[model samples]
Target: MTNVLVCIKRVPETSGQILLSQDGQSIDARHVGYTLSAHDECAVEQAIQIARSTDGEATVLTVGNDDSLEQIRNALAVGCTAAVLVEADTENFGPADVAAAIADAVRSRETDATTYDLILVGNDAADTGDFQVGVRLAYALGRPVLTGIGTVEVQDGTVVARGKGPEGTEVFELSLPAVIAVQEGGVEPRYPSIPGRMKAKRTPVDMVTASVSPVGNGRAALRLPPSQPSVVEVLGEGPAAATAVVDLLYKLGVAT
Candidate 1:
């Protein structure tokens, strides 16, 4: 059986305009909605699939405040068998801090004889676009890590991962007890059923205090790029616009 742990982050939904805080230190999330990153969602689904196939268990973990518990419960509702919440002031937590906290939690579980056979995370943070956590976590745990992986499978105590490379698809095999940073588009995450949500509500979450101090990422401030102005062009009118549309499509290389 292969036990898996999936780490996720609650990020602001990017469908709407993203604004920075007045101090420019962080995102202004007061008016924004939050959800799991696409990559993290896929990673959670992969962990669930792996656990189900191996008749093991999948656990979800996150380093954040109480608001993060909603995300943990969502993962549990879909399929994760267990959940962990590492309480910390995530506003000041950087990639290194998150990795350290996760490493500490993993070590704590190891001390209790709860060994995870595989760990999964998003290739990068959706909000910050930082790509260091998985690699740093692997280094801290002394485990091999693969990033930007799209698919993962376990066989013979090893993980076979496939991802897109510069030329095309590339595959790698790594020993068990490894870390994988997943990208989106590998698998579709399942929606939580009503019963699943109810069951998840009753599942207990293991709460742990972050052992590391918050160290902000070395960015002085954040700046948003200037918005591009929109332009609208009107073709002719009625059937007369058909020729213009065809010509425009051909000019844009959309038509032969």
Candidate 2:
């Protein structure tokens, strides 16, 4: 019997209207209503695929506040067995600190002598898009990691992963109890059907680490930038405009 644990993050929905902080650091999550991140959604879909393929159990684990329960239900609606939430609400909680907290959580599981065959995570959260957590956690866990993987499968304690290399597509076969980060496209994300949603709503979610001590604390103040002048606009005759545009693009190193 193989058990799979997927670690996911609730991230902000990037509506075009939203902008980053003025200092060019941190997001204005004030507008960031939580949602499953794109790559993390792919992680959930991959979990479902593996769970179906092997007929095993897959559980979702996340870190956030009460606002994150909806996202957990979203995961359950897709077909995950259950969910666990770790509330590590802090501002100073850098990637390393988050990784440490996850390591502590994994150790708690280890205390029971319970071990998962595979652990899945998004390559990065959309908000920070740091592309760090998966790798960081893997490092903390002292496990091998396959990063930027688009397609992945687990079979008998091994991971068969597809990633893009400089030349083209690269495939990896790594031993299990390992970590794998899902790429943007990867597998198709699943939506909880009406029935699935109903079941998920009825399903109970366990909240562990209720008062997770945050490693990073404090929100960086945020403000929008003053509107900038238009970068591009079309005008004048079509034929000459096309030629001029092409010439300008080439000159600007935009096109050849």
Best candidate (score: lDDT): 1
**Residue lDDT tens for model 2, 1-256:** 5677888877767764676756755565676566778889998888888877887778888776677888888999999886877776734576766676677777787688767677889988776667788888888888999888999887877789998889999999999788889887778897679999998998888776733455563446555667799986664576767887787788899896
lDDT of each: 0.93, 0.79
For model 2, state the Cα shift of residue 61 in Å. Answer: 0.8
List the candidates' TM-scores in order: 0.92, 0.83
Error of 1 at 97 (Å): 1.3
- Can you write out model 1's per-residue Cα lDDT over 57-129, one digit (the tens) per residue? 8999999999998899999999999999988887777899999999999999889989899999999978888
Residue 189 CA displacement from its true place in model 2, Å: 0.8
